[model samples]
Target chain A: MPVTKMIEPILPVEKLTYLENFGHSLRAASYLYKPSSADEIFDVFKVAKQNHLTVTLRGAGRSYNDAALNGAGIIMDLTRMNKILDWNPETGMITVEPGVTLEKLWQHVLPDGWWPPVVSGTMTTTLGGCLGMNIHGKNNYRMGPIGEHVQEFTALLPTGAVMTCSPEKNGDLFYSMISGMGMLGVFTSITLKMKRVYSGLLRVKAYPVSNLHNHLNEIFLAAPDHDYTVGWLDATAGGSGMGRGQIHAAKYLHEGEDPDPQKTLRVEYQTLPATMFGFFPKASIHYFMTPFFNNPGVKLVNTAKYIAGLRKGEHLQSHAAFHFLLDYVPNWELGYGKNGLIQYQSFLPKETAEATWNEILTISQKKGMPSYLGVTKRHRPDKFLLSHAVDGFSLALDFKITIGSRDKMYAMLQDFDRIVLQAGGRFYFAKNSETSSETALQFLGEETVKRFKALKHRTDPDNLLESNLYRRVFGS
Target chain B: MPSTNRNSATPLKPGKCAIIVGSAKGLGGALARKLAREGFVLGLVDRNSELLVQLCAEINAGNVGQAFPYVQDVTSYEEVPALFQKILVDLGGLDTFIYVAGILLPTTPTTYDFEKDRLMISVNALGALAWFNVVAPVFQALHSGHIVGISSVAGDRGRVGNPGYNSSKAALTTYLEALRNRLSRYGVHVLTVKPGFMDTDMLKSSPRTFWVVSPEQAAEDVYKALRQRRQTIYTLGRWGWIMFIIRHVPSVIFRRLSL
Candidate 1:
């Protein structure tokens, strides 16, 4: 058999010094290939294999960490391969190339009264990234993660085998690739079961909660009736007001119930205004916010947000506006400065969520490094091999990176891991940057880790598909 | 011209039916692929019958949209009206008509060739006008359609390096503007696309070009501009400001600089 059928000349590998992720963490990669088609993807894999270079697949580079970055190796940028392969309105099945972003998918399908079953906080993230991380949304409790709605997918394995896998076909590979973080292969195409929608508006209600107990209680109470439920926790809240925040519950409006007179089935999704954050220099904003990155300033901002949420209790919003809250303030992460930011999201079982969440908050407050933003969401356990959900609640906290906060943040994360592991909780890989191998092994359990390792070995025996994240977490 | 019913009960899919001129290769081909992927039943026109047939087969195999190839050169101005009418009938209706058929001949002020200049002007300017003459009335009759013309940033000002190509693009841009002004009253949109240095075969031999975007990037910008109902756009966007400054330069200074 021919080792390679060279269609396009493999461009000379160039050194890229600053492959900065969304969170502003920079890494180096030896080569970057923007393959525009499936055949090109296969060629990329072959070239990587020939050169004995580990390949890391990147879609949109929105992972906030090293998940999409590979130090001194090839980075396969899949954004150019964006194309919708097929759409069947009768069955609500849409087949799309892996590079299609959620925004583009919504733009194509929403006009046809179809919506993605699950959408992450930002619409810029690609389908491939969602599948790789097995991302969950606010409605995860109802619709599950993106992987659950994925009917099938075709991936180019490191062995140069193009396999179509689904729940009914190539079942083992299907499960492995769902949350495999693109270790098993590069996804070429995905067939998703898009949910049908009657209108583009969402009816949302917000309630202010006092403490961790109230937050958990409100989420549990809202979960049964709401299609989507999520809460913004005030991390700076201490003592009596600890975990005080607002819980937002929403559902898609019926066909005729939308308040907008101009409402149509084909609503155009609005992008964030360029002037939304004002015309301040990004670096200057970061510098100004550095002093306010502490407990008191964050508390005041959270308090104001709480009051604003209370004032706007019930309202109608476009589906895009409701789901993509992060996009409203363009470059919001720039406020965290050049050192970047790290998000640590931990999921704990419902039985121990209240106490463990309190402990986590207390540790941050005591360290004087309280998180700037905290969000809570309910999740149901999924069957994917490396699933992060646990039929419980997950608290995601964002901490700014300061001059000497790396060691402090790592030390604090270690403490968090100990508490979470003791409480039978686990960490999310999408937002993780400093998770240790031992912590990951302990959190994932030995049997599951061993099984994943065996599968990884079978798919990539030569370790062709490797990333810095893979080495840090899995220790391959 | 066949008149499409404006009040038909069938809902308007955003980009249902599109006709792409010069759909055989480069930026035109990229746009054809993108529109098809976005669920537009396409009428692909090109002089290269073989490549057009291959593209149609590939698009059909992908199952994104139906592609119908029309192997008529745009230079044949008399054939465009009948060909467009046939395409409209075959595709059921029209929603978008993108004229991307253009040529760039290497003719400087000192080495001006009459044959090359005529070919460039006919293909890039008059050919676009031929398609617009046919398609604009159809879109007006329907009162709901997008007419896009791919002009060039070189159209912003004439340069000595390639005067023929620049003037041709300038004429196409002005024609598109006139069309937009006339079509606006009937709810029809006209977008003039001005792209800078794109990494296409057309620019393969061009030296020292900055901010070169891929055809895919240019195609994406074109699609976005269409969706936004923009009057005119610079693909990869920054070229707008670059051209703005270049257009405002004094003749004394401009004559001294070799762009």
Candidate 2:
């Protein structure tokens, strides 16, 4: 009788390293392996199964918390697998590898008069990560999440099964896995339907709003007419000025609107300037902004911005300039320092948005750790199983973390969660890091949580897929 | 680097490679000798150059198994990657990774020394995490390896006397449990040893002590557990029952007395 030998995968153990989230707040040590193909990913799964190590799927590590972190486990970095497989300019449909970033996708299709239907504030996020989190753009109220724009995807499960999922085929898996936070499987390829655009420019109008009521009202009213609308709140402002800020509403320019559509729609015109005023380097801007990360300094900057908005101006801005404001200054998040920053974003119903946000802002200021920056946007609910949207408004607040302020800040955030939950609000996993298991269950409902867990068990019988965020919120 | 075949007259018996971190003194040093006697090619690592060199020489002189000395500070997390790779190359192959490096600075409820508390957390908890991160993936790939973490019984409950020590152990204990959960499917054995009182400098500052055993005796228990593939164990055995009672004590009443 001939004996068959079992061969173990040859892992690159020297590749053990550290990985951090986008905000740089949460970090973990893991063995990072960049697999170039679905076959390599399968080998990784085989290795992880044999070694009893959980595997986390990572694309650009753009999450705000531990969603991409798996401590003392294996991190499968898909960035190397980036390749645009197919594109059809006529149909506005494109197929790309999971690691293809929004920046790469937009740059490739923009000259052809197509843009990603939805994108986050930063374009560096990967397609797999976006679908995993089901990110939304300023136009969320109109287009829904990026998942709604996805046509289909191929995923590799832990059970060594390759599944092709779409709305019509394996519908439950499609709806659940889109916002599943990379728990079900690894996305190998994604086919997305891009939004067709006539021109690159958007007619943007900026005006200042007064108090919490006007901020919410103005955005709700403007969203109906504009393709994209967002508000910047002066968190430092108190009393009648609470939630007072500026609103910028933008509308897409028709084909005939731009005198030279070819010139305006070119990638060169759509790209942000490499330098501010064409002299000072944009990459170094964050170092100078560091001095203003504190409460007093941010208050001064917010006041100046509000004062500048009082003039109420209108201008034509490119698509990149309008959508990717977070990337305007390179490494801008570094201004928050080594402790980094955490964002608390909540989605509330229109009926209770004003009242609930008012209480949250008041409590934040009262705690003496007011958020450095606040942004508000209108949104409509989607059908994703773990949706964080509502037919109302969403507020995102950025809090700078200091050596001694973490505990206090977390306590305050828990209080904010209580107020939001009472007002029937929901939380996004991609942002907020301090959400407790009970809060997740309350917002997602017992049925939804149970169903997601059931699907997870069925797909990953050995529980090979997991991340820090999944463990923290799901409490499994 | 030091190596010798002092027992050249006797046939050498080498089974598998094992690395004992903080093997310069105490339970770590004892465990190093025990594994060596069991024919494990050893990689003994510690920050104390003098003690580490002496231990390495002693092991080589015995010639039961070969030993390599690596001097490294456990708190220097960034340097772990290079040293980990070097140790793997020197050992040819690894089958067991034992993380016994730790520190216990005197802490009291009355005086809060941030520096001391920080050092304890750094060495006792975070340092272990850094080393474990390097070894886990290799073991997972091989599908057969042993990981042993030497935690303390102090982690069972938050005692008042040594706040930092108790909390660091608690964190380490919880982390090991999580690792066990993650690595169990691969047939990897993760052993968390929660020893009670051991005769070492670490416990000399305690207000009181009982059931203290020599490092040699404790090593015997640990080696037995490692061979048996036990998930967890309390050295001296009775500490398990004692901690059970201490853990269940209602906090409202347990707060009145220091264990």
Q: Which candidate comes out best when scored by TM-score?
A: 2
Worst 10 residues of 2 chain B by lDDT: B2-11
lDDT tens string, model 2, B1-259? 1111111110011136788998999999999999988777888889999999998888889846778999999887777776776566455457789989988887666788878888899999988988888778777765668999999998999987888898899999999999999898978899999998899998888768899988999999999999899999999899999989999999899999856
Please give, as one word, the docking class of candidate 1.
incorrect
* Candidate 1 residue runs with Cα over 4 Å from true position: A1-17, A259-262, A269-294, B1-259
Clash totals in order = 0, 2
Give the distance in Å from residue B79's predicted Cα in candidate 2 to where it truly belongs: 24
Q: Residue A15 lDDT in model 1?
A: 30
Lowest lDDT 10-residue stretch of candidate 2 chain A = A1-10
Best by lDDT: 2
